[model samples]
Target: MTVFKVFYQHNKEEVVVREHTQTMYVEAQTEEQVRRYLKDRNYNIEFITKLEGTHLEYEKQSEHFNVEQAE
Candidate 1:
């Protein structure tokens, strides 16, 4: 299976906070798979900016980011 990098954007809102745009990423086989995975987790699919192959070299070229929790 090929490693597909999925980039998507979404919004978050709470009783005391305003909505804002947030970025997300996932490794999947296809775009549809990524969509399904996110949907299953109740994440809305606002926009998909791009999809590309990770080239299986995650160690050499991958950039990591921290996911923050909403309060």
Candidate 2:
């Protein structure tokens, strides 16, 4: 499973807008897979403002988790 957070701007005011949070599990095994998925979905390349890597952790005893940059 791969998760992506796509951010965009909707207006000239420059107010940042979080467009979508997407999670996909694809059989294809490369960056090209995700690229093709985006193209197939007709997601505009211009709308994407920024992308950040997400680090996910899980603990059996805890029900909650957090996302942070992994160094």
Candidate 3:
């Protein structure tokens, strides 16, 4: 079985896919069919994994401030 690391642009999430596995597998002969399958299923990567594809990686949207400049 071949393993592929899928990456999402929206949330920057990643997921691993394998043959005959039940992890959002899109099987279609044509590109349109595949697209339709994904769209119909509304499949999305739940969590983003690191480059090693072993652990989940999360990023927080925080603001950084400089205390010295903040008078």
How should the candidates be ordered by TM-score, best one leading?
A: 1, 2, 3
Q: Give lDDT tens digits, candidate 3, residues 1-71.
A: 11222233332233434332232222234434444434533345432222223321211211321111100
What's the CA error at residue 37 for candidate 3, in Å?
0.5
Q: Please give, for residues 3-57, the per-residue lDDT of candidate 1 as tens digits.
A: 3343333422332222543445555556676666676453445555333345334
Better of 2 and 3 by TM-score: 2
* C-alpha RMSD in Å of predicted model 3 compared with the true structure: 17.6
Put down candidate 2 lDDT per residue, 5-35, tens digits, no spaces.
Answer: 3322333344344554323322233444445
Lowest-sum lDDT 10-residue window in model 2: 62-71
Against the unseen true structure, what C-alpha lDDT does each candidate score? 0.44, 0.34, 0.29
